[model samples]
Target: MNDIAAIPVWAIIPVSLLLIVGGSIVLIGALGLLRLPSFYQRIHGPAITVTLGAGCLLIASMIYFTVLQSRPVIHEIIISLFLLLTAPIVAMMIMRAAVYRDLRAGKKDAGAAAGGIYQFPEESE
Candidate 1:
């Protein structure tokens, strides 16, 4: 007998809901990436949504697999931990790089809008 068939309807409902919600959140993030006007703004879409979406998907996988195996499957927790740790750091690094680049190019507005935290030497003409 296939393990998939062993999953009860009660377990299936939440798993399906998680998958759908996760997918929808990811789609919204993609749309935000495409629709947002600026790089600073665009990064937020994926950075925020990816974490939430992946979390939901991971939970769905855990529930589905646990139900199939008749055991508690918690490996997703580690994956989630890594993702939660890294995603924001990566996004911050990318934003910092962009801000640095903009500052080096004499665009003070970018640095200013970035809370004026970066100090770049003014280019002598």
Candidate 2:
């Protein structure tokens, strides 16, 4: 469209760069999620995407819209706020569900499996 082309080259360049960087972040997150072998490893992928990748994309969106509107458009902040509010809660719930499932299955190694660094001994009952 004519309007799209009317954007100054400087604005276009930065916006395009932001979008590319944001997209790359998201792609890397998805690839990480898919390529990881264990659920614990996989959890990191989405968490990284949600925290970092989404932040990048949101910043890109904010920049693009601000450039397009010739002013600081803050609508993206609402979405960012919503995401910030919910993402961690959802991730925690998901991890809790996984742990609950493992516990329900009576896997004595659940704590050990979840603990990536410090070793947790299996409880004796």
Candidate 3:
């Protein structure tokens, strides 16, 4: 758009930075999900890291649209509010469910290495 083209390079730099940072945060979170050893540890990926990533992305989008359109682009606030409200709740629910399942299966506090993950030592032959 003409308005976007007219925006200053300073604005563009911040927008691009925010987008890249947000994307990197999301990627790191996804990688954490893949690399963490247990359900509890993995849950932190989307709950904290992804939420932060989405916040950064949303902020960048807001700034870009606001400056580009020469108006206050505020719908992103609603989305951010929803995300803030739901992320922790969802994380807590996931944790509760996982904890319940572990307890039901008699694995509560079974190990100490992050989310009750056990590293069993092999016996010498």
Best by the lDDT measure: 1
RMSD to truth, every model: 2.0, 3.1, 6.6
Model 1 residue 25 CA deviation in Å: 0.6
Ranking by TM-score, best first? 1, 2, 3
RMSD of 2: 3.1
> Which whole-number lDDT from 0 to 100 does residue 121 have in model 1?
68
lDDT of each: 0.92, 0.75, 0.82
Write one digit per residue (lDDT tens) for candidate 1, span 8-118: 999989999999999999999999999998899899999999999999999999999898887899999999999999999999999999998987777767756567888
Worst 10 residues of 2 by lDDT: 111-120
Give the clash count for each candidate: 0, 0, 0
Which candidate leads in TM-score? Answer: 1
Q: Estimate the TM-score of every prediction.
A: 0.89, 0.81, 0.81
Cα TM-score of candidate 1:
0.89
Clash pairs (backbone) in predicted model 3: none
Tens digits of per-residue lDDT for model 2, 1-108: 876876778777777777788788889889999999877678778876776667767877787778778899888888888888888788778877777676668765
Error of 2 at 65 (Å): 2.2
